[model samples]
Target chain A: MYRYDEFDQAFVAERVTQFRDQVARRLAGELNEEQFKPLRLQNGVYLQLHAYMLRVAIPYGTLSAHQMRKLAHIARTYDKGYGHFTTRQNIQFNWPRLDDVPAILEELAEVEMHAIQTSGNCIRNVTADHFAGVAADEAADPRPYAEILRQWSSLHPEFLFLPRKFKIAVTGAAHDRAAIQFHDIGYEVKRNEAGELGFAVYIGGGQGRTPMVAKKIRDFLPEEDLLAYSEAILRVYNLHGRRDNKYKARIKILVFETGADVLKEEIEAEFTKIRASALRLPADEIRRIEAYFAPPAYAIALPGEAALAAARQADPGFDRWVASNVTGHRAAGHSIVTISLKPIGAPPGDATADQMDAVADIAARYSHDEIRVSHEQNLVLPHVATADLRSVFDALVTAGLATANAGLITDIIACPGLDYCALATARSIPVAQRISERFAETARQADIGDVKIKISGCINACGHHHAGHIGILGLEKKGEEVYQITLGGSGDETASIGDIVGRGFASDDIVDAVETIVDTYLERREGADESFLAAYRRLGATPFKKALYGAA
Target chain B: MANETARLWKDGGFRPNPWQDWPEDGALEPLDPGTDALVPLERFVADPDVFLARKGRLGVRVAAGEDVAVLAEHLENIALIALEFPSFADGRNYSAARLLRERLGYDGEIRAVGDVLSDQIALMRRCGIDAFLVTHGPTRAALQGGRIPEVRHYYQPVSGPEIEIPAGSRPWARQPAA
Candidate 1:
């Protein structure tokens, strides 16, 4: 919830003007498509399957009610009456005309938001744990450092045109909700033995055609050296990362080719040269940024526990939701509420304009005017008082935003696959819809227990299928759409890429295949208490493969 | 291709290019004795001793992915280091230019050649390339119009005359233009 100062305001305003000029140039044929592509991409405009998609950055997944309203307004006016929240914690409007994009950018700037660095081969929008400041297990709030990085990476001259697009994620909590391990660079904010704040730096992690869990290059890097160290890492990658083959261009490949130890030595040498340079974060500046995210004053001695329990008992639907969607908060009498976008039989993460407006209102009323978008494609009301849970649930239910499947089998994370993306090989949304419909029974889902089903349209893994407990990748084999399954992947504190099961299933049989795998887990689990991931880890992929492919 | 009519922009205005490219047709060829001629890095590296011993001003054109360290010790002898962009999106030259200035401390003229556009002007300047050999028609027009679209308030401290000092307590924020 950082507010924009004069300097920040000026920067965004000028960027709008610059983008306006670029658009005019492209329209007038003063620049060709080849020249205008990167320029447009930097501003987050993408030519999708049907129309130009505009992705707006939600920095660190934090938003104010006012900003959320503006996004709702954009969806209503410029695009279709809904927006798709992506796995990277950003939102994409899939139908904005090229001529309307500049105006859209101007509107975004009014709310201290812009599409800058949301795309293109640059330091992209920085993400952090959605529950950064309010999480109970947090060692430090990462928003301050994330914001510092956000400012530093925006239009950074030397890093704008890297060998490939770069993503950086930060996590302050012991639980990695940000999926930091799958990013180009991941930082875990923690306190050292002496009680000083620093980071355990992880580098060269990403998922595309290749999936990699990041390597911890530095055990502890002082918080003051954040930007300096980042610069060193980027400088090394920009100069040496592969460019001849686009597939091998990510820094992860560089880390693989050069070996992590040698690459670490090179990065360390560069860090030594610039550690005390102008990029070092001054303590006062860090404190100044931190003040913006300081916890709001909590109401003392609120009577919510008894009322919350009574409300839950009164309504089984609300009780189920409370059990699944609610999480503990650091402050007393408060809870973090996850408003599931993955409603039964719906396109996951697509929030209608009305739903957005309703969520904005709910956030203003119950969550101190703040909302967060999680990387799992869900919205979070981070500071909902336990007393207000029933009322919040009622409001969300009215807006069709209340889904009692937060971490359950039906809470799927899927991408806008062949239906929207130009790069997609097959359909992903339809498959997710089918699976959701197949498991629509709440009781059945509860019986099945926690299972993550992530679907991607192509090998790009935008849906993060690699991290799914049951990963589904949609591909075109022999000009026929086939869904491949991978099991045992998790994106949490213990991150691992899933392994592919035997052969893929056709579109017609894919839903049944997923059901078989779920049923297999239900039979194989130690008990209902044993989660799908835990069971998969304990049992490995053998039983699931047999369930899907038979014991051949 | 290297355009002979392409304008050279230095210190904020367009000027005539003093140095002519060797193999005027822009081919990879053996270097011949000449003054004020810009040759490819490969030709110069083929025989640096011979090129340094010649009686002429030397300029080396570096490809996008060429190793910049090859020019480190000879930076003093070179008058201009032209970093190629092959494509505007190929940004390896930006790193190469920064290494030339910040790492090697090569204060001599650094020129951004090939695929140079107005949109990239501000970034190239920030990376310590003070000279631009612009060929794209619209970019040349933009440069001549003195309307290079740019964001004056920068977030990173880069070496260039275009930026002032870091404003107030935020060392990351470069002050806006007066």
Candidate 2:
């Protein structure tokens, strides 16, 4: 929702020109692959298994209709007419040539977007709750603070090449939709007892080969000291994080190696010295950023409960979609609508060019010309009128974007596994597709209730399988793709990594194993009212393990 | 060997390095008085008084993982602080350079020595590193020619003069005057 001013415009324009020169140098053999690798990565270009994948940043998961249209245009012109939305709330174009990258960047710049920091060991795209301003339980819209961090960390001179890539996520609501606990640094916007705003800072949390839920480093850091405190954390990590082993290079390992108390002392010392510097965000600047995220003008009216109920009675499909996809909004007469990108048997987050265009059109018409990409691999119309829900659903259905499974068994989050990623040891998309097809019936998925199935192709956990209700991690055991199942992981306010059930199953047996686990939950649940996550919490992984592999 | 032709970039141009530097061959020794000697921090810390007594320009070569805070008290006396990169991916020195400039307010020459590639030159410069001890021929040529591609506008405030946003304009839109 934030518009680019002239300075921001020129900054991105110049970056495009700079990247264009880099590409030219690479093509002319003036720079080798080793020399060009970091440069290309900083601009979001990756040398994947099949082709160069360019990931474009959607800062704070916010997009305008015009920007969505431009993304569709890019997918149509440069890529293979489709783009995959990643778990970081960014989108990836899997097929873009080296030469076309600069052109693609130029187009992205026109729409106030770029691929900067989407890859490489720099401060990555700052993410926040997708329902930041619109959510009912929000303390403050976290986007303002997230945008401040975006500006502060972009091409940060001191942190350009950290020991490893750094990820920062912010969440405004008490619900924690941003998965704050799994990031390198997570900020939960909080208000003190005196009613002054600040942040509850968590550090040293990440999921890769090693998974860690972030530990709280500061109970309450004043909002004004945000950048300075962040600098302190980064400075400590940059100066001390391991550089010898790439696997142990993350800040999480540093916090683990040197106890959290020692790390906190170091961070506090650094913060003391730098807290009064110019990096401390000014009040006017905070207010200026907050103005950009103010709620859209809404028609004051009662909730559209009667009309929604009548429509649901008329069409069970619409009723099911409303039940799963619609979420409460802060403003009356408006609801947050999630358009499921995880359609049956398709890649978890892939949206065709036509689908993107249709969503853009729907946003322009039914919503307030704004779109949001959810970390669960879905697009959100944050301010859809409750009356327009059916119309929007109809348009989405026509464009193949309608899937009545949000937060249901069929709605899955999966990484680009062996199909595209060079780091993948096993295939992830096919596994997600198989599970989706196995539970394609809407009634069955609704009956099963909210069970998140997340899959990752490797240990990197890019698919965030560690946070799934039923987590599946694909590994190569003696040249065979084996699926390891974990149960009872959740990424909400009460964040916890899932535990592995037992020995992994072969790829052929994974789908049936998942079904058995789901059926096990259905039988073991207190009632249909209790979700899979809640049931798993009540009954630990023992029953699920027994269901997957026979009782030991 | 290419090391013989290694050029030093300082004060916006390349020049032959005046200071004599030791090879990073895992050895430490006292300073040689006739020529400027850059010794490892451990060597210098073993006998700071001996290094201080030398009647020549003194410098210290710090590895990426070394605690740079040890050099804080000696910032005013040291002529150069050479930060090693070990590998281009190891970016600890970038933080070290900023600490020297911003935290310690050390204004003397800060040279990026090892694995100083062309792509990182602009970044190193922005972090208050004013010099480079470059061995790669093409990288040296690019530095000498001022051909390292860089964006003029910056989003973050660093160790340089803050470009004031024009009054009545959005602060983020302000760019450094051409």
Candidate 3:
């Protein structure tokens, strides 16, 4: 996590005072609703469907134990005792009073966390792979670059009033756990033939009404040019992006209308003009930033157990958690652990105040004080000792954060939807809850095998349905909520937008429709090793479509 | 530099209103335009004595009779700088005020003028303005809409002069962002 210096600290504190005065002015009716709207948004406060929702940026999904504790404190004092982690890896506290929000922001500034750019038409929170530093296959930790971007974009005068909100994601490894393909700008860190590090840049990928996979504009962009190139892309979009229709304002729509080839040419020409200017990342400076994100040092030795047979024999529960929750790490004797916030039948990403404290304690205890919010809306203990896995698992279990179902069906990704979001035409969390309840049995989930189901309430796809192995998109037709299922979408190394499965399902029938598809996969899978995505790829949506509609 | 402890300027900036400084009717005689000589911003570097002597003193209060931009352009030569902010968030004056202080490096009074409100006094101070000409009263609004709450802020830098980022890794830009 990037620590705030005096400048960063004082800026936020001053902003708090500024916001407090703005609120006073608004209350006095000196500032009208129109005048107050943008200020509130820049501060990350929104008047949602139910109450004012404050979305706090967990910059690039990273949080210190202190920051997490502060969030937990806010959750307990001001908001409902729970906070919802978003797909972009930020957290939202629903039901916050507008008047109390400035005070909450003041406390947040004390811990070097604020809600700037969490909403409105501006550069948003940057995202990256949850297991960046700890991933065994990582080329480099992506968060340093992400932090740099966060600083550069925060309240940038040139970009504050963009045509639409922009999202950027970076992946440190070959696997795209960050859902890089679904963001407007995606950076894949990979080594070139000469072993120099660089990025494979993708542009215009988004998951709104027009969900499109970003086209690769630059095959290899050196790491230093990240900001300048990103600026160029944004500059082009800021100037030329359509403002006529709100739905048509995203860069994805522009890319679609202008054609990828033409867009690429324009971006390249812009890049050339700006590449050598102050924006290019000089090697020494990049190395300076890179130093901040260097992997935490571990005991210079491999894990005693190359095999997990001993752990399995010692404790069955720990064994199960290790099998499911433990992931590969780049450092020896270290393993990445995912503490599933999505406990069976609970909200997909809701972590209570106490649960937050407990997760922070465990992260500081087993790993460094470092924790990451996953795009799956879960929390990651990035560098836990393999030996301390048992202790970490026990602590997690007590917090109700332990769920040995990382890629299982019950670990569904869902947005707040109509339950909270004003833009949602339908509900997603309820659908997710229904499915989780349907498959509450651990044995049933284990049998399903690496199944991923993502649901979005509306076209925004905040739940990332477009990338789900079993994607469910909610829609409204004739004032009735309907769901359209898509098959074969995956948010991994091999990413693709799912194909729409046939006709839509009524709101009441959506749960059953999803169940029918899952049951179909279970019955028809060729072998035990074939994962849901592979099985769906082989069988196609036709069979699942037929399974649900009874005719295809 | 807002939140000046002396608390002299009630408005957000250093624009000390003549009404506040003296009597309510403390008015100055309006001056007519001299000639076609545009005030050069570099007078502080050119013969400072000559520029100062030539420009003389500017009026504490600006009227429709005087050109604010011309005085603003020669802020370096002028002993006093008073900028009128019609209303907070009507940030048009923020640019003009910032130019007077930052671009011309004016060290004298940089006050907020016209339609001044006291509530924005701290904010005006932060933007590097020195004083304000305000409508005395509670900086409260027309209606008691409600209280606005506070949370903590994460970042430190706002668009200003003091904490210039000295931004690293310049990008290739054919045009400075419009």
Tens-digit lDDT track for model 2 on A1-552? 798877678879988998998899899998899888989999999999989999999999999999999999999999889999989999999999999999999999999999999999889999999999999999999999999899878888778788899999999978899999888999999999999999999998888889988889898999999998999999999888887788999999999999989999999999999888777777888998899988888877956779889999999999999999999988888899999999999999999999999999999998889999999999999999988888998999899988999999888999999999999999999999999999999999989988989999999999888999999999999999999998888888899999998999899999999999988888998999999889888998888887776777
lDDT of 3 by residue, B79-120 (tens): 555555443434335444543554456666665555544434
Q: Every model's DockQ, to 2 decimals?
A: 0.77, 0.61, 0.08
lDDT of each: 0.91, 0.88, 0.73
Weakest ten-residue segment in model 2 chain A by summed lDDT = A543-552
Candidate 1 lDDT over residue span A1-552, tens digit each:
799999999999999999999999899988898889989999999988898999999999999999999999999999889998988789999999999999999999999999998999999999999999999999999999999999999999999989999999999987898888898999999999999999999999999999999999998999999999999999999989999899999999999899999999999999998888889998888999999999888787788999888888888899989999999999999999999999888999999999999999999999999999998999999988898999999999999988999998889999899998899999999999999999988888878878999999999999999999999999999999999999999999899999999789999999999999888888998998899899999998888887777788
For model 2, what fraction of the real interface contacts is kept? 0.75
Ranking by lDDT: 1, 2, 3
What's candidate 2's DockQ score?
0.61
* Candidate order (DockQ): 1, 2, 3
Order of all candidates by TM-score, from best down to worst? Answer: 1, 2, 3
The TM-score values for the models, in the order shown, are 0.97, 0.97, 0.78
lDDT of 3 by residue, A382-442 (tens): 8888878877888888888778888788899998888888999899888898888888777
In candidate 3, residue B75 scores what lDDT?
A: 56
Candidate with more favorable, higher lDDT: 1 or 2: 1
Name the weakest run of 10 consecutive residues (lDDT summed) in model 3 chain A.
A154-163
